[model samples]
Each structure stands twice: as structure tokens, then as C-alpha cells.
Target: MRVPANRRTPLHEIAHARAGDKGDTSTLSVFPYRDEHYPDLVRELTAGAVRRHLGDRVRGEVVRHELPNLCALLFVCRQSLDGGVTTSLALDAHGKGLSSILLSLEIEVGEIEVSPSSPPR
Candidate 1:
């Protein structure tokens, strides 16, 4: 997940992801490689950001739930399972690929100003 020399890098470099699904709802959990990055990661990985990243693949709403104690972000993407594994014709109806796709999102590297909501490192 290491990106070229630049001011930005893929989120995967700083975090890892896990995904789960039930019916047409999919949840993606983003855990930071270090808790120090948790706040910035949360600010960057909003519901809207995930929604935009997924584009038309997500027909319904995208919601993000924060878990500060765990230094993780949980994204709930609705209507994202291609109508659930049982109905979808696609082989990956479970939406496992969505987790990897989330990891592909870019985040600022080098130095980034911490937001007021961010916790101390």
C-alpha cells in the first residue's frame, strides 16, 4: 500500500479494513495502524467520502459511526450488496471487495493539521 513519494498516500498505508454484510447492507470497519492517526482518519473517512468513492455502486445512504475508544471507523453502506448475496447475479454479492476498495482512498501524508475534534496522540 506504499504510494510514490508525494504529499499523499493511500489509507491502506496507515490503516487496515474489515467488511461484513447482512441482506443488502454492508459495513466496512477501518482501523488505524496507529491510534495517533485515528482522528485524522475519521475526519477523512466520512460517510459522504465513502459514498462518493463507491459512486453508483451504492444506491442508498452511506453512514459512518465513530469508535474513538477503538480508534476505528465503521461505515454502513446501504443497498450495496447488489440486492444481497442470495439475489445478486454477481459472484461477489457479499461485498467483500468493498473493504479493499475503501483502503484505496487517499489521505494526506507528511504533515497534516489536526482538527479540533482529534484526540491527542
Candidate 2:
């Protein structure tokens, strides 16, 4: 079904995410549920946009890598781990939960057909 024009929806509704971290950088990969949504993801999920959405959680730069063949976007976030897994005092020292936070970000889907088969978070 088509969602309203300019309507905001949490990214989880359209995509799924996976995240991993090494040292101070976190790598997040987001895949849209439908391949047709790739361009929309590319347009909306910019490096600056992710950095702004993450706020102080990401102290360094956010770089986005596009994988058009996979219909995915990979975000490399620097200085986000509070140091590293061993050094950070944060509860989620590995930054595993960052994907959840990333999914919570709202995007304007306009009139796209959101798949009802979107998996649960």
C-alpha cells in the first residue's frame, strides 16, 4: 500500500540493519526490504544525515558506502565506541545496539509501497 506523501516512517519499516565495530569505528549496513527502495535510501541516508541522527554518539566522521548490487548502504562511523570494546565503559561497548538506534530514525517515504512483510526488530 502507498504511504502518504511526505509522511515520516521509521526506517525499520522499510529496511533491516546490521552493525559491527572495531576499535573506535562502527560499521553499519542497512538493506532495504524492497530493491526498488535503494535509491530512496541513497537519497535520504547521507553521511551527514547519519552523523546528525547519531549526534554525539558518533564523535568522528560518518562515511556511507553504496552497494547498488546488494541494494544496501554501509555506514562507517568513527569514534563511536567510547574507545574500543575493552576500553569503553558504555553498556553496549561493542555498539551492537547502534543499528536499533539507526533504524529508529524517521525518513520521508512519500508515496512508496512499504512491504508488510518487513521483519520485526
Candidate 3:
């Protein structure tokens, strides 16, 4: 994925956040390869597919943009919100019948704290 030029966060910030902190809300980055012939992976990554892959911890949101080249799906999930929390699972295409064709899959989770609206900086 391409990051906006003005953005300050690093490309691997999400992974770092997941590893450095616990119990904080996280944003996960995912990239899945559905098929070899397809140019994009959206057809393979349906809402149900994402739900099943992410399990029960997350809720998915569809954010549409005018840029045809930039299509994406976002998922929001809840974390401990207290202290020291950990969750894990295996994400191979065992039952989904996509084990053989799936060439690449990546997931990154990070902690983010959103508060009430702040005054202009």
C-alpha cells in the first residue's frame, strides 16, 4: 500500500505498536492475494471472508474513495482498554478452500487512542 506523502507514521508502525503495547485499541493492516489472474484482491476478500479471517474481535467497515486505484476495506476492533492483553490464532486457508492459490497474506495490529475532538493545533 502507498502512504500519503504528508503522513508521519512509518510503514511498519502498526506492527511496532502491536508488539510494544498491550491492552490498547489496535488498527490492523491486511493484504491478501486471492488469485493469480486477478489484478485486485477485492473479489476474494468479501465481508464474510474478512469476518471469518479476523474472528469475532473485529467489526468491518467499507470506506469508499473516488480514486479508482485506491480501494480498501477497514476493520475496527476492540482491545483490553485496561492492561496487558494478548490474543492469537492460526490463519491458514484450511477450510476456506483457498490454501493453494493464496500467494501472500499480511496482518498488522496496532494500538490507537482516540479521544474527543481536540482544538485546532
Candidate 4:
């Protein structure tokens, strides 16, 4: 486990994400700020872990697609928003904010990987 001895930070600090929905499924793309973090991202960001993290919001198994060439991960979240945005009555109809929500999940980072003085892209 890459647990932090100091303080933990969210994925947004080291990665960028985009989310979209089709019917009841939400697809998220997470791209690391640097290529060096791809392996670490792969080790830490598993489908089961994401499934557990999202809990009931995610009704089915999470699917993870590794893109080493791009240093990114694509996550397919099934039945995540009650239903499709068009059918769901939730305030966040498009599930647009889910990316930010995902980015909020904590992960450990070394000072070299994420410096306080540096800005996240």
C-alpha cells in the first residue's frame, strides 16, 4: 500500500479528469500530470477500489481500462446516477461533477511528485 506517512492529497493534485454519461453508465478519464505516475496510478486505482469508494452510487462492477501510452485510466461506472441523466431526477443530471468528486479521493504523494509550491494541471 502506498499509504502516506505525512498528509494525503486528492487525485486532482496530480491528475486531470473528465466525465460523461450514457444511459445509466458514467465514464471517467483520469490522466496523470506526468508519465512517471502511470504505474503508480495503475497499482492504486483499481476497479474494485473505485467500486468500493463510490459505494451504492455505483450499482454494478467498475471497469478499468489502462492506457499506458497516454498515462491515463478510463473507468466505466455502471448505474452510477440512479439512471440516465435524462431519466434521473437528481440535481446533477449530467453527472458532470462526478469527475471532481472522483478527484477528491485521497492518495499519497511524495513531495517530489507533488510539491506544495507547484500548481496542479
TM-score of each: 0.83, 0.89, 0.28, 0.82
Cα displacement (Å) at residue 113, model 1: 17
Instruction: Give the deviation of candidate 2 from the true structure as CA RMSD.
Output: 2.4
Clashing residue pairs, backbone N/CA/C < 3 A, model 1 = none
Across 41-77, the per-residue lDDT of candidate 4 in tens digits comes to 7877898877776777788779999988888999999
RMSD of each: 6.9, 2.4, 15.5, 3.7
**Comparing candidate 1 with candidate 3, which one achieves the higher TM-score?**
1
Worst 10 residues of 3 by lDDT: 11-20
lDDT string, candidate 3, 1-121, tens digits = 3333322332222211111222433333323222221223343444454446445433334221122243333333344122223333324211222221112233221222223474211
- lDDT (0-100) at residue 79 of candidate 1? 95
User: Candidate 1 on 1-121: residue-level lDDT in tens?
Assistant: 2233336678876789999999999999999866767877876888998999888878999989999999899999999988899999977899999999988988775453344575434
Give the Cα lDDT of each candidate: 0.83, 0.89, 0.30, 0.78
Candidate 3 ranges beyond 4 A from true positions = 1-25, 31-39, 59-68, 78-121
Report the number of the highest-TM-score candidate.
Answer: 2
- The CA lDDT at 113 in model 1 is 39
Give the poorly placed runs of model 1, Cα more than 4 Å off. 1-6, 110-121
Clashing pairs in 3: 26-110
